[model samples]
Target: MSLFCHRIEVKSVQTAGIIIEYNPMHDGHLYLLEQVRAQLGADTAFVGVMSGNFVQRGDFALLRKHARARAAVESGVDLVLELPLPWAVASAERFARGGVEILSATGVVTHLAFGSECGDAAALERLAEALHCEAFPALLRRELERGDSFPAARQRALAQLTSPKDAALLSDPNNILGVEYCKALLQKKSAIRPLTVRRAGTPYHGTDLVGAQPSATLLRTLLRSGERDRALALMPPVVRRVYEAEEAAGRAPVFRENAERAMLARLRSMTEADFARLDEGREGLYRRLYETSRSACSIEALLDETKTRRYARTRLSRMVLWAYLGLEPAAFPRQVPYLRVLAANGRGRELLGRMRKCAGLPILTKPADVRELPPVAGELFRQEVRATDLYTLAYPDLFAAAGGTEWREGPVILP
Candidate 1:
């Protein structure tokens, strides 16, 4: 059968995989979960989630990772697994690969469902096919020579082969992330099929969603505004209740400029070799970093100074994240060594039981549970600590109340 036919056939699966980062569990996420559960019956869908010190958006999880996971379980997620630092922040390709790989690794997920404007699963598959075309390599090389970053180079190259306006296809963060999901599923060649859910609410980052709810961006914006009650208004009752409890316990969420600055300062101190070591280091990227580091006062500022058509802001941000963690692309763990249980309720717990018997990876339930970390695992954990330290620094009051920890090896799970 054609690749299109194969993907279409996957809609009839039992369990589905959702790759998400619910910065603050909001109504939009609830809507997505409802759709997933409706599409595939209960207990059948598996949710492989990412929760760490930082999010893909290059910020702290509004609520802690464990809290976010619990929210997922409360919402109806069956399983929630942690996304490692490399996959968590590397790039769209790595994130998708990591997410798909984790869900696929569980050995229970049969369908990979996600929100997208592209609508048609077959079209995304076609896009995926085009992305891997034999001619793309040469075309990409030409674009790169024109001083475009890898992402920009690929987009421009694809546009040349396809439509002139097609460069916009991979521009949005959502679409870029979507394409990566398709690419990851294809690269792994796993039985778990890929599906894209037509977005029903607002755009990925759109702030307004009148009757129903606002996007996570909107919610974060409100929460960051110090209007905790108003910010809590954007989420579901369960989420608001949870946030309320955390708030009552003295955990008022705040954007951590200090955390970001600490990380940025570390980035500024790095030499060119350090930049090259943390992936995205090729051609003149090292040179760009060496030059940009001289005047960078913050992570966002450094990105603004160095960003160009050749080096997208997001790409630079990911590279900076890797640098903070000391994660070199050359040293990434070849295979997933373990699945850290971040959060799960009864259903999530049930899925975990199934994963135990079927999962190919070791499941980590405790923070100290690193008996068998693949090569980069230790360093990856260290990066997470750095991120948390940054997070704590940003919320000194919160951190101070919560022991103001340096880093703990074991499960720092909430609830």
Candidate 2:
């Protein structure tokens, strides 16, 4: 019954890792955590590898990572690990790969769980296998040549090579990422088994709050619209409390538009060659950015000017973020170099003790440790620092906008 390369010993307690952004922890996230915990038994250790200040959607977190991680720990997760900025703001393939790699490095984790629309592990694995088939690459290239976006082309190729049902899974955001998680597990030859819980309530992009478990999108909409009470109602009490505390401290509710001026300034300063080196920058897209930045006065304007059928808004947004951060395509490492602890509870501290013995990579716990990393890792950490500095500028309070928080702040420890 084991899907992993190594069989779990009967006497050992199981540990499961979840990959999440928790951009703002809501009831839906709590549901997934509770469901997975129930399935694995109360004794199972729950670990989460979460995105940092930036998230996969090419936006800053509604709240900082420390606040979000604290909420996750209070809700049910024992430990939270930081997924570095490069991968945090990457495409789905790289995002899932980075998350799975970090979870696998922990060694004690035997299973990887995610929320998916289909929640069928077997079907997801089949789709993952199809992606690796020898024919997939040629078909994908054909779709790309036809001017389809990468996601659109990949879905079309999967539909043609496999079935419409399998391809349709990609339409559901969670299912698409779930498939990538399985693919990463296989690619890494990881010993962790993959699992999925059914996503409740609306689709990932649904904007209206409708049930006990609402989409994060809907929650964000409510919060941004000044419907704080309504948004709080859709989250656990502890999560709500953390969100309130962070807001009181002037560090919550950061939006992409907060950095509108800085973003425009950075783009205006960059040349076509500079944009060409950003992730997803290619085929003269850099030239488009260069031309557009001259007249585009707002982030919305820049996006409208540069976006095309070939370049999705999310992809363009990620590219813009990379350009703003001065990150080149070669900046990221081929593989993740370290496991960083962002937040942990008492149980999490115990798990860290275990990781020290079995972790394949270094487990970083302090800002000073950045000095000890190899050249590549040090550069990656510097990118994170720079990103954090820029992120603080988005804080509602000017005093909170002062940089260097990355060095001053420590992991959130929940009692």
Candidate 3:
């Protein structure tokens, strides 16, 4: 259960891992897989470490992780590993670190591929190096002291130290996360090389369905508005099938608005001390949250009330969700505890077998396996269980909403 351990030698076949949320599997994701596979050759296994019911954007996924994992495997991924709740909902730095740690622990991956607005891997690595320098901290601190947001401060610091082209890359969301992935790889000193595919089709935050590959945000909008056919067209055939099946069973679309009441109630019951324990909860922000929760009728209202120039709405939303889920900053393990398999095809199963021998961390294939974890790891696992229970509460079907789906559901096996 040591947090930082020596990296073990990889023993399995060549594999590539992608870090993703896949709120709903879309063609853009498939394109990345295709590009990676084409570059690496079809023999190379593709593993995806995906966010669970919750995501980094500080919200519940449009569909559950299992469903999304299944779609991923059906479309192209050889395997899908669950990125635990704590890290999945964390900021980009932690999210990237957690994912890189898990993928590295698997002892099979040779490359870490990610979508980047700036497709140059070497350039991103240089940016990562600059950001990791000892001098960057003092420069960043000065920018923060000037009241700039964390992202803005980091960007300003980078601009002062690096080329304008490199600094501008941070402004794009995909590039920001891509830089973090590289940073995490450097932090771990992992042997896994980083690869980036230029983002195509729609921008990350675009709202319109442009051509065949619409943004996940646009697809979510379409699904929420009952425009199923339109959304389906933006995804691959296999992914479309999964979405259609989930919707038919009354469990496809789960939005933030569905949890508004539960979120507000959870916030109202907590004191400033309780809020103080959440990530990014500090500097009287907990007091602001406590006050806002008392009068704000909805999650949106509470967000609007508490959000400042320094804090983005997405950060506020994540904080509220963390408070609702009773997640404390200390609850996260210093190192990722395990790689929980969400879905796997035959080739994936082979990779798992090789991983069992060399993986530095435990590889969990079922819910029962969580019980064998150390106290710290088990505590983190329980957070995921609670997250599943809370997430199911948003399902359209009452039976599904009764909870405990995490225990009953196993890794999705695709033929």
Candidate 4:
């Protein structure tokens, strides 16, 4: 089996891999899917590794992962797999690495596709190369010592090492992640080729719905604010129906505020030593978190107290979320051990048949299949199970919240 081959053989299957959160599966996501299919050919299999209940923005997803996966397949994606909790809530580099690893392990993806503000694959690759140079770390450390945040310090370091033009690419969020994806591919020495599509319409952090394409951020705001019709209008018809069904079942529009008290209780109960273990930066952030948790009454208040010029609010949010979920940095795996299916269409089923022999990792279509894998895989699955149980506590209908749902539920298969 050629585990990470980038080259496409004559008249062979061509697969395109994408990393997505699809928090609500809006028009912008649909546009990317359409563009990739048009560029890669209609028959090219598109596999998306989606974030489960938690998203990279350091918050709960607007909807459940399986519901979003169903919307993804209905909208156009061939297959959807879980990105796993550790990677889903991690920093940009690890998030990109985990997504890339899952795609490469499939042994089928030829191109890793993503949307970028720069939309220039060569420029992103060059930026990735600049960050990997030996002298870059010293330069970055120098900038950090000046009390600049990580994002700012890294950009300055790149400007000094590369050209200002190359460093400016990091100004855009998509470009930053695109560069990380390329860096991950380079680090793994994998054969997967990086591909970028120019991101169009509203800015990534845009807060209001506008024009033909709106950011997921805007839609999420609308959903949480009870502007359901406006938010659903931005989504595909099938996706709208899916979200509607979830709403009817009292499972839609999950927010951090729903479980705010629980989160604060968990954080307040932790010791300074516990916070130290969960801190990834080793920048004495745990001390700030420990101090802040005592007086801070709400999650927002805790984040407000802990926020600093050097530490972004998003980073602090992840730390708080991990503490709430009992996730220690040590528990996060160095490598992804298996792929868990979320949803799939007929074409995805065909791809799975081929993956059985070629895949680099074990595939889990049913939760119980985890028993056949190594102990590490089982441990990860157990974490996922516990995560699902905790996630249910945030449901709009308390009666609908139930444990052991992860074990009884299987992947959503569409004929």
Which candidate has the highest TM-score of all? 4
Candidate 2 lDDT over 93-157, as tens digits, reads: 99999999999899888899999999998778878878977999999999999887878999999
- State the RMSD for candidate 1: 3.5
> What lDDT tens digits, residue by residue, belong to model 1 across residues 1-415?
3343344343454777888887777777777677777767653655756756567754556776666776677666766788876667666777788888888888778888887765566656656777877898899888878865677788888786656554566766666777778877877877777767666665677776665767788788777666667777768887887777666655547464546766767777888777777644555676786678778777767778887765667667666666665667777766666787776656666677888899988787866666356655665666666666555555536435343242453433332
Question: Which residue runs of candidate 2 sit more than 4 Å off their true CA positions?
Answer: 1-6, 9-12, 279-281
Sort the predicted structures by lDDT, highest score first: 4, 2, 3, 1
Candidate 4 lDDT: 0.88
True-vs-predicted CA distance for residue 398, candidate 3, Å:
2.1
Model 2: lDDT to the true structure = 0.86
TM-score comparison, 3 vs 4, better candidate? 4
Using lDDT as the measure, name the better of candidate 2 and candidate 4.
4
lDDT of each: 0.69, 0.86, 0.85, 0.88
TM-score of each: 0.86, 0.95, 0.94, 0.96
Error of 1 at 81 (Å): 0.7
Model 3: per-residue Cα lDDT over 1-415, one tens digit each: 2122335455434588999998877888888988887887777789899999999988989888999999888887899998988889988899999999999899888899999988998888878888888899999989999997888898889988778789889999999999899999888888888889999988999887666678888888887898878778777788888877887888867887887888888888887778777745466677777888888999988889899988888888788888878887675667787889999999899889999999999888888878888877777777788888998888777565767777778999977
lDDT (C-alpha) at residue 320 in model 1? 68
Q: Which prediction has more favorable lDDT, 2 or 3?
A: 2
Error of 3 at 314 (Å): 1.4
Looking at model 4, residue 402 earns an lDDT score of 83
Residue 354 in candidate 4, Cα distance off native in Å: 0.7
